[model samples]
Target chain A: MADFNASDLTCLRGERLVFGGLSFAAKSGDAIMLRGRNGAGKSSLLRVMAGLLAPRSGALCWNGENIADDRAAHQSRLQYLGHQDAIKPVLSVRDNLRLWGQLRGVSQLDAVIDAALHALDIHHLARITGRYLSSGQKRRTALARILIGQSDLWLLDEPTVGLDRESCAELSQLIADFRATGGIVIYSTHIDLDVKNPNILDLDDFAIPMVEWLTEHADLNDDTNDSANMQHSVSPQEAVQ
Target chain B: MSGFMAVLQRDLRLALRQGADSVMVVAFFIVTTTLFPFGVGPEANILARIASGVIWVSALLAAMLSLERIFQADFEDGTLELLALSPVSMEMLVLGKVLAHWLTTGLPLIIAAPLMAVMLNMDQSGFVTLMIAMLLGTPALSLIGAIGAALILGARRGGVLVSLLVLPLYIPILIFGAGAVEAAQLGMSATEHLQIMGAILLLTLAATPFATAHAVRLAIE
Candidate 1:
């Protein structure tokens, strides 16, 4: 069982302190739900944990050592599925997944790709290029790579947006399978996911200081307090809860 | 090694599938080289005098035309994030992409340069030197341009910005590539010019991968 821990993490996004004093820990077979309104720093927090964004202050420990000591080793064990689907428009569905598997350094590819495509129910669309796939299909194609790669930690950001009901259930089962196999899963969503019980880490609690900082300066800006977690894409104002 | 080859193969496949980008690069090289004869004159001596310069300049522009897209497609589609997280180091990843760019963009320009030289009525003695200079010089263009492309990721006017950023660095290659041909025409060995271009190529091969990889990480952040 692998151990993953993040302690006293503060994300300094752009020029502002997006979130602060955040911490979460999980071992294999654990799933932590990142609950927060938009810019309450859910996505940014995921990026930081994914090693894409640098935390202003904190420690990310994997197994027993700090990730910074051996980032490639840490990254090799993780897969980050961000807001974008990461599909190549010109490549066939199979080629896209195949390339991803190759980049992950996975050998014996045929079995893995077949299993992944089957898990996402995209095996039938294997020959189609990305340009012709519908939005939902693209999402499924993107998710399929996760199965092929079999990363230890999956940092998914709102993965169910374009999935249909059946597809959503399929994804839930896939994640459930991943967890049952002792993989650690972390995700962000506005609505509930159909996983078994999950550990919830509300980013709002960590964002208290930035909200305070905003309010302190709201005296001059006036509008900063009105829409507290103002952000586009997911419209984070509702995340202040 | 497989990771590097994986990226190289994937990019080559994408280049083949899209087709238009590669075609446009070759087209620009041909069109730009031909326009020079019209701008100056059709006189054989004049064309020969300017052939090496025109071909080298056009090749640089052609390589730049596709430079911004080397990482742009991957960056836009979020594949760059995945690449960053891969077991491969960022430096290797950058080098892989640069080599891939050379195959799709620089290789095509190299194939077209000799023909363009003939079109410009370049002296027969200069042909070998012109090809040698371009073969050595174009990789450096792709490598150096990788840094500019990586820097301007997601910028609003990335095309123009890459030109401003990359053109100055490209001047040295242009000078040496044309100078090699000029030396050959004057019945002198172009060895020194070719040697310096090789130095620039080796330096960029060692250096730009690290710089471009750094810029890519920053852009992703």
Candidate 2:
């Protein structure tokens, strides 16, 4: 069964501490919902899990192997849908899907693209340019890429964003079906997703030691006489503004 | 290999659907070449003398026009991230797109150069040399341009930035390309210039893609 594990992870974006000392695991037929307010680093955490961004300190493993050791092999069994649609406007819908399948080494690319388009309800627009599609249509086309190959793990960041109710419901069912087939899904969203026994990881619970450290350092600097001199060196009118 | 073919096919399909873009690029090449004669006062001697350099420069600019779109669309749509995440090395992906770019833009210019040469009053030998020079040089332009494209993926004024960054790197190609036609025009063997252009193409083919891939990764980050 497909599974992913993250251990003692710490991530930082410049001086801001997004999350630290966090750990999570997702297994076959399991769905993980990462919930947090904006700027809580939900997306950053997702990127780390996807191996797109490296954590300052941690280990991400797939199955029983360290993902870093066999990155290509681990990546092959996974599909990630990020915040953007990632469609090429100049390309027709069918050609886009065909390329995705072919790149992943999926056999019978035409059949795979056809199946994906049919599933996404965009079969009629297969020959249309991506630039001409609506926002929702573009999102569906991006979703079609996930359906092209047989990936065991799916990392979807706001997959339902910009989708209509019907489309959202369709996507929910698709994720459900994938889980039922023993595929692993880790998705992040602000809205509630109606799924059974969902495991929730709230980023708010993760501590940001880096932020505290920066604040403390600033406080120490403020107590020094040089700090007053530096602040005073600025013209009064300039400082006031 | 399948990964390479997939990228090649995807880019080619995109170019084909755009329909007028490739044609327009070739048209730009011809129109720009034609402008030099009128601008320089319809002197056949002057036209013949400057034909090689004029054609090479025009071809360079036309090829640059399309390079920005090569990775910009993919990067915006998140396909670049997926491609990077794919099992195929980013270098191979870059190479595939570069090959496709040459097929669409570079090949057409090479094919259309002869007609432009005729219009410019270029010598027959110079016309053949111009075609051969473009055939050798334009792929290097496309390959080197990929690095600029990837570097400026989400930057403000990316189109202008791509040209500014790439045009300087294109000088070696320009020198050899124009040199070949000039040698042929002067009744000297153009083989040395052709060899130089071919070497530049080989070096770019080996190095530029990795640099492009790195630039793309940084841009995405």
Candidate 3:
């Protein structure tokens, strides 16, 4: 059984604080849904969990050990699906999925690949090159990539976008099956999904309010105690000017 | 190692499927080298004198032309993000991409350089040295160019920016690579120049993977 936790995570994107004092934890067989309006740090949080973006402050722990201490072990157990489908226009759907699996050092590749494609209902479109696939098909292809590897955690950012209702249902079923197998999932999306007993984290709650952000900006503008503030936040635009 | 091979195979497959990318690079190398003869007038001695320099420069530019493709497509398609998250280290992934790049872009340029050398009336003695030098030098071009490609990711005018960023770093390779052929033509041993080019290649090979991987992580961030 694996335990994943993020505590006091503060993330800065460019100069803006995407989120602060944000924390979440998930154990085996848990599904966490990240919900908030647009620009509410949902994707940033996902990226932070995936260890792609280093949070300015805080730590992510897997099985009570900080992930930063062993990035390779952390990476081995997680799969992250971002906004892009990662489909190469020149490769067929099947080849595209296999490339990811192979890169992850997945074994029994043929069986895993076929099963994933079938599960995603893209088996018929497997031979189709990425350039010819519709957005829905592309998203399905990307989803299928998550199934071929032995990942204990899945971090999906807007995994439901461009998916049809049927495809969404398929994804929900996949999530259910993954949970049943004791895998953990954390995902962000705008649409209603049929994930069972998801622990919802509204990013709006963790977002620094506009008033506080404005005051911080004002404080910076006033050059009051520059050293303390400069270490925490230096927006690229500010540095340029 | 399997991950590295997978990336290499996938990239080669993509290059083969696209069909036109390597061809365009080779054609650009050929056309650019051919123009030198026309511009300088077809005097054999003069053409011979400048042949090594022209071929090395053209090869450098051709390699740079394809540098953006090394990571641009992967970055845009989000493959890079997933790759960074995968079990394979980012450094291994960068190396895999650099190898595939050399195979598709560098190998072809090596094969084509001989034809251009002949056209430019290069001294017969310089031909083998030209091939050897490019074999040593082009991988460095691809390696150094990888850093540039990764740096310019998500930037505007990345193609132009990659050349500007990598071309200055390319000067040392150009000096050693062209110097090798010129030395061979002048009846001096080209080994010292070739050895230095090899050192550059090895240093770039060891260093660029980490640098390019770091740049790529930043680009993703």
Candidate 4:
């Protein structure tokens, strides 16, 4: 019965309104493929969803209640992987997963770490410290942290940045298995990924029209205060344009 | 398994694995304090006269040495972002990391300060006072330094900027700390200075986590 939804969300990065009038919803077992060119706000939108960035105005809800009402509770239910794979350089791959597993309060932790390493096919590299990892191995280590059932929702900024084809296939299988267990995944990438019947969201369709937004805001308040109303009169439905 | 302990354990393990971070801090403490006696001439009177100041200043800088590492690696590799997404409040996570930094860096400086004092020809009467003041003061260094460390998380030349921002804030601890030992050396009651340093430690303990956590959250954004 769990659902993830965003309503009337607008994001501003510094003075630029990255995206405005954007809304999306997905339920358990859903996969959302967030597609866009660089700077199209795919990353910004994911960060906003994760509560890492405060959207200019929006409501993120879970099960019909505002997620902002209980930010910690909302965050505890999900995991996020950004472009930079969060591997600690000194800890071995196994220890990195163990640290996260313990933080998430996962019981049977040894088994979980073992299974996660196996899923990503990085089990043999578990004993080596992260500093020695190749680019693909580092990405695999980052992926293993998510495979351990620590959180049911995943917000991946670019999960496939350094993954090889075999590794990509393994990751896609992991995601599919997660969905089979009622997990929700929202991933952003420029390359095609092997996802099952994904709900596609191209961020270009939802960007703030910079020239129009500037003229409209300049008319309202000439200096410094124009950022507050940049999303005025834009409808989420109009984002389809 | 608790988030605080998990972070603390990881940081300490990393510190041990890296192995050289704590050694480098202690080495800096020893080397910097050693330079003073030679520069001021081995006259016990002059060395003793400046002993407290030299030790405090060196320890202060030594604490700054490892502050950059507090968030730098995690920030660079994006572990900090995952940490942000955890159920643990950023403030608690900051506290754990600060405690780990204290154990690795501040604790060693405390162990080394008294030895440096002896080498600098400090008065025997002031030795215990120096240890007490440092024990109280170093935690404040780690705590206050964490705020500076986090504020400069993504800035260019973060190491330099952390020292610039943190060194000024360290003045109060340095004053009260060095003042305590100097008072003891002069046969005066050092209790007031020691009490003030204790107060500063308490204040930083209560306040810096929130400030550091706010900075950490901003860096993540």
Candidate No. with top lDDT:
3
**What does DockQ come to for candidate 3?**
0.79
Q: Rank order by lDDT, top first? A: 3, 4, 1, 2
RMSD of 3: 4.6
DockQ of candidate 1 (2 decimals): 0.78
**Deviating ranges (above 4 Å) for candidate 2:** A14-16, A89-92, A117-133, A207-210, A215-241
Report the TM-score measured on chain A for model 2: 0.86
Displacement of the residue B1 alpha carbon in candidate 4, Å: 8.3
- Candidate RMSDs in order: 5.5, 4.3, 4.6, 4.2
Model 4: DockQ score: 0.85
RMSD of 2: 4.3
Instruction: Name the 10 consecutive residues with the lowest summed lDDT in model 2 chain A.
Output: A211-220
Steric clash pairs (candidate 2): A86-B77, A86-B78
Instruction: State the lDDT of candidate 3 residue by residue for A1-241, as single tens digits.
Output: 9899989898888988888889989999999999888888999998989889999889999999999898899898988889999998888988998888887787889889999999998899988999999999999999998998898999999999999899999999999999999999999988899999999999989999644665565544555665446544655546789
Q: For candidate 4, write residues B34-126 as lDDT tens digits.
A: 888778788999999999999999999999988998999899888898898888888888999999999999998989888888888899999
lDDT of each: 0.87, 0.85, 0.91, 0.89
lDDT of 3 by residue, B98-169 (tens): 999999999999999998999888989999999999999999999999999999999999889888999999
Go through the candidates in order and give each one's DockQ. Answer: 0.78, 0.68, 0.79, 0.85
Best by DockQ: 4
- What CAPRI class is candidate 4? high
Winner on lDDT between 2 and 3 is 3
Give the better candidate number (1 or 3) by TM-score: 3
Could you give candidate 1's per-residue lDDT for residues B33-56 as a string of tens digits?
Answer: 989978998999999888888898
lDDT of 2 by residue, A1-241 (tens): 7778999898878667788878999899999998888888888988887778888788998877888888789778888999988777777888767777877888888888888888889999999987899999999998888998888988899988888888888888889999999998889976666677889999888866553444345643565775666456555847689
